[model samples]
Target: MLPHERSLVKRLQSQPFALIGINSDGDADKVKKILKDQDITWRQSIEGSTRGPWPTKWNVKSWPTIYVLDAQGVIRYKNVREKAMDEAIDTLLAEMKGAKK
Candidate 1:
């Protein structure tokens, strides 16, 4: 995911796109090391230790949950990856482009 996400970030740098990560690892030191080792540069926030973690609030029960949203912030795709994820993003971008013209 690190490398693929990095490629995605680079590929879509000029587009209205962003990749946000919510890390749930309990070891802050390890997390920091992993980020540095993996060269993760996109926006990332450690999952809070509140009563309701982001996973609970967002109803996520697994790691690597992916959601693809459009400009309107609607969840147009869920759990998409690789070529499917790319297609979903491209379709949304094309739709946005067509709507403006």
Candidate 2:
């Protein structure tokens, strides 16, 4: 699996989070199928054209980008390249727990 894919799986298993991946080229269906086969529930949105969430909203420049958003739909982690995601999950959980306190 891709680093981002692995990171997503880890998050889904451990947190109250949702994974949404965008494919600007309109090929997200294949990725979705693969994830489904692995029993990974992910949501995907495809842009109408090459004009992705850029300059006006999210400013994404690459394909297979991952955005980890909080409950209020605000982006907390926007790493273009995927990482291990352990620290990120800890930080997000801490923030959520702090808010609840």
Candidate 3:
């Protein structure tokens, strides 16, 4: 997942795309290590625990919960990955281009 995420971030460098990581790790030290070891370049919010504010509010039932939001900050897709994720992003980018014109 990290590799794919890195690819997405690199590929969308010139676009209005953001990959915000909401980490639910209990230990802040471990999270920092992960960020460095994994080479995570995107922005991250460090929630204290799985029961932390972000996860609690979003009702995250799984570990790697994925959400794809549009330019207007609306959640358009959830729990999608790989090809489906790419398709959703591509469609949204195209829509963004059409909207600009």
Candidate 4:
């Protein structure tokens, strides 16, 4: 999934797309190392603890939950699978482009 997402990020580099990651890993140093090793260029925020306020605030029930937002910051899709993510991104990008024209 990381490989696919990394590729998507690269492909969408020219577009008005951004990937934000919220990591629940407890160890900050380990998370930093993993991010660097994994070549994750996107901005990420690390939760102090998995059972902390961040999870409760976001209502994250699963490990890899995803929320896709549009240009206006409204969540267009939630908890979509990887394949669906690609389609959603494409659709949103098209909408964005259309709005600009």
Candidate 5:
């Protein structure tokens, strides 16, 4: 993720952002349901993580990673720790506000 991507993610988190999980491990269906259960809407990009567009293709290495992106399609946060969603959201929101001006 780039510096601008971080800023964009912070902005999105301040409002409403989507949690997209790109799994190349063929567990897309299972993970989709989990996110739904949490009332979080997500999309599974079946391109198998390692064979996608630039940047994503290079950085992705693990399964079940979360990427929070803004409406502009710029990644705000990637490889987010699922256990720290709350803190991440709070920090992202605050950062977004700080960078708004």
Candidate 6:
């Protein structure tokens, strides 16, 4: 997922897009090391404790959940499959571009 996500980030580097990760990893250090190793440059909010407030607030019930939000912060896609994320992003990016004009 990280590799695919990295590719999306690279492909959309010129557009108004962001991939925000909400990590529920118990160990901050381990998460940090993993992020560094993966070359993940996006902003991530790490939950140091298991099933922390973030997950509860967001109502995340799955291990790996994907939420694609628009520039206005409205959720445009929820639980989007990894394979289809790029297409969703493309749609949103196009919408954003149209909005700007």
Could you say which candidate leads in lDDT?
3
**Of the pair 3 and 5, which is ahead by TM-score?**
3
Residue lDDT tens for model 1, 1-101: 66788899899999988888877765567668778998887876677432237777898876778899999999999999988888999999999999999
lDDT (C-alpha, whole model) for all candidates: 0.82, 0.61, 0.90, 0.86, 0.55, 0.83
Off by over 4 Å in 2: 1-7, 27-40, 52-57, 80-84
TM-score of 4: 0.90
Off by over 4 Å in 1: 27-30, 48-52
Cα misplacement distance, residue 73 of candidate 4 (Å)? 0.6
Report the lDDT tens digits of candidate 4 across residue range 20-61.
Answer: 888887667978988999998877777866765778798788
Each model's TM-score?
A: 0.86, 0.58, 0.92, 0.90, 0.44, 0.88
**C-alpha positional error of residue 54 in candidate 2 after TM-score superposition, expressed in Å:** 7.1
Which lDDT tens digits does candidate 3 get at residues 19-89? 99999875778888888999999988889788888999989989899999999999999989988888899
Q: Per-residue lDDT tens digits of candidate 6, residues 11-81?
A: 88988888888888766788888889989988888886548888888788887888889889988897776
What CA RMSD would candidate 3 show? 1.2
Better of 1 and 2 by lDDT: 1
Candidate rank order under lDDT:
3, 4, 6, 1, 2, 5
Candidate 3: segments with Cα more than 4 A from true spot: none
- 6-63 per-residue lDDT for model 2 (tens digits): 5566656767765555545445676566556766556656554457564226666655
Give me the candidate number with maximum TM-score. 3
**Candidate 2 whole-model C-alpha lDDT, 0 to 1:** 0.61
Error of 1 at 12 (Å): 0.6
Worst 10 residues of 5 by lDDT: 1-10
